[model samples]
Target: MLGFFKRDKNKIAKDGEDHTVDSMDLLGEKAETTGKEVKTKLHFPPNVEIGQEERYYYQFLNNELPLLKENQISLSGIEVHSAEDGTVSVKAFLRNSLPKGVRIAEPITLLLLGPDEDVLARQEFNLTGLGELPAESSTPWVYVFNAKNVRVKEIPQTDWKLAFELKKAKGPHTLDLEESWEKSLADTDKEKLEQLVKTIKPPKPGEVNFMGIQSRLDDAGALHVTLLIRNGSEKNVKLEQLPLNVEDASGEVVAKGAFKMEALEIKANTSKPWTFIFPKELVLKEDADLSKWKAYVPQG
Candidate 1:
């Protein structure tokens, strides 16, 4: 299913070797604890192959299946403690069940949320620092939070939810283009697409900017928004799904939804347009004045 990373085995082998050294440095520099430390362990199953074509469908089955029966990422044996100087220490065991070839390129965003679902503190933990794991092997991770860094008023005793967001490192496209889209393009366009894929570079965070946003009502009274996004980054960006929020003048979120990009891929240093149609039923407020609302991509 993932064919992009295999294009150049020799190059990947070299990269893999370099990854080991990078992992060591990353682990040592990040996720170090200061106060009292605790230990724990977690076990995970192997990555499952369900033969599903759609990504979301696979994700649904992955989440709903029993932990023992499913090949999945698992976390357990979490321990947290606070020192007298207000430093907080956290430790947890993690097991990765993702395909053996896949490697984490970025630190996973860890969010501690309050009772009202507000984020109390956000931190990033680097799993790549531990290097690649053999399918079901376990790895322990530690995180230290200084009192001056986090926004939490006090150490959380209970009633907190930990959320994790993982982003893979920039690599070749794993999946092929949709058959319908490929068939629609001319031979020359197809060649250009392939060439772009080979030469495109990765953009920095916040490099993608919005040029314009316009909203309209469809015949069925659905809200459709047209957005012009400029790719200011050095590499192409795949925009299959984009999570965004629209807030009012007072900073209250009036509407939120993920927009599916029809074009799918945005070439580096170029501008592309995407249209999102929100069903009337999904509108959070009936009289939401979207005209003056500000739109932005929310950080995880």
Candidate 2:
């Protein structure tokens, strides 16, 4: 895992007050509908652990959306409508399962998928701009995707679905470091690595991003380069075999190698910093520019 990671700054939920806010209150200021609304009610399984008083307060919400499942964030009653402004309007009830209230300000991407699961369009939204979300309750909201984000010019009237681009983890790590790397790392290098984590943006789901740490031309005619590999997906990835081409500032290949991964597993939502050795025999250019270089997969 990327050990020298920055601390997550997500705001915590507030506690210590009894309040009586309607389930539909969060949606008033946003998700504005110009009449002609087609809303649907969802049925959910009951969680007996909910106390009576809290249950009573949520009774109205329960009739519309199922009780928020334990440790799960789900969307229900997704409806698509034509906007008066000529954009696509998507309304859905976002159900929060966390026991405590939370605020969502992160850049969230919503995808419009076709009936065959093809992505029609995607747009990013910040929920904090809309409003705060209560704990274990379903809140309704409308997302509008503009023309640029929409791929297909002719929109499909039916059989389309709206969903989150990627699922978020329940409790994300606050600089989660793998055990082995933490032990042998030096203080100065650790600080630099931490800064790298903060400086380099993370990769999207299912993709791996690499940042060069150090590149030097060895006296033995080899090029040794250290890299930080980031995996931003929700599922663990095992590198079976990775073939990479090392290119310098001129976009000229300096070194190339195929690695045999004996055992390299990058956990979900983690980054791993590693050093790859391009042997002297494999080094194609000895005088390649090391100041600005990149490592990428070679194309056939």
Measured by TM-score, the strongest candidate is 2
Q: Name the TM-score of candidate 2.
A: 0.45
What are the runs in model 2 whose C-alpha is more than 4 Å off? 1-179
Which candidate should be chosen as best, given lDDT against the real structure? 2
What local distance difference test score does each model get? Answer: 0.49, 0.60
Per-residue error (Å), model 1, residue 228: 11
Tens-digit per-residue lDDT, 1-300, candidate 1:
121111222221110000011222322223222343122122222342323432333233234322321234444323455567766555434544433323556766665555566766677766565555554344444556566656776755455544453434444422234456566768886565566534555234548765334776566656666555656554677877788766654667656788776647766555554556677765666566666666678898
Cα error of candidate 1 at position 275, Å: 26
The TM-scores of all predictions, comma-separated, are: 0.34, 0.45
How high is the lDDT of residue 251 in model 1? 64
Determine the C-alpha RMSD for candidate 1 after optimal superposition of all C-alphas: 21.5
Residue 134 deviation, candidate 1, in Å? 2.7
lDDT of 2 by residue, 1-300 (tens): 111112123422111111122222322222223333222232222222434543343344446443432444555434555544457666555665544455665777778777677887889887764455555556545567886787775556556666665543333311335566789888787787777676666677677667687889877887888777787777677787889899999889999999887667777766777778889989998789877899887778
Q: In lDDT terms, how accurate is model 1?
A: 0.49
